[model samples]
Target: MSIATISTFVTAALVLVGIALALLVGTVGVAAYQFFSQNRRVRVARREPLVGYYRTLAFG
Candidate 1:
């Protein structure tokens, strides 16, 4: 292949790889955020110190 064709192919490959990496990272970040938020909410919902009582059971 010519130099121009090789260069174009390399450039396209790099761009696609970069985009794929960005998407994967973004998806992971969002999933992590959601998990933490849900954990926080559950903690808040079940914050009562009393054990074996209705509040603890409700939180769980």
Candidate 2:
């Protein structure tokens, strides 16, 4: 094959690879954020009532 044809193929392959990687990273990032936020909310929900009770006992 000619040099131009080979280079064109190489360039197209690289672009496709880049797009795939970006999509993969974005999916993982969103999953991680959701996981962490869900965990955080659970922790806060479990703690909030205890905190309010303490504040009432201490200040009232």
By lDDT, the best candidate is: 2
Model 2 scores worst on lDDT over the 10 consecutive residues at 48-57
Alpha carbon lDDT of each predicted model: 0.77, 0.80
lDDT of 2 at 49: 65
lDDT of 1 at 17: 100
What lDDT would candidate 2 get against the real structure?
0.80
Question: Cα RMSD for candidate 2?
Answer: 9.8
Lowest-sum lDDT 10-residue window in model 1:
48-57
RMSD of 1: 7.3
Compose the digit string of candidate 1's lDDT tens values, residues 1-60.
999999999999999999999999999999988866666655667674434443554585
- Error in Å for residue 47 of model 1: 7.0
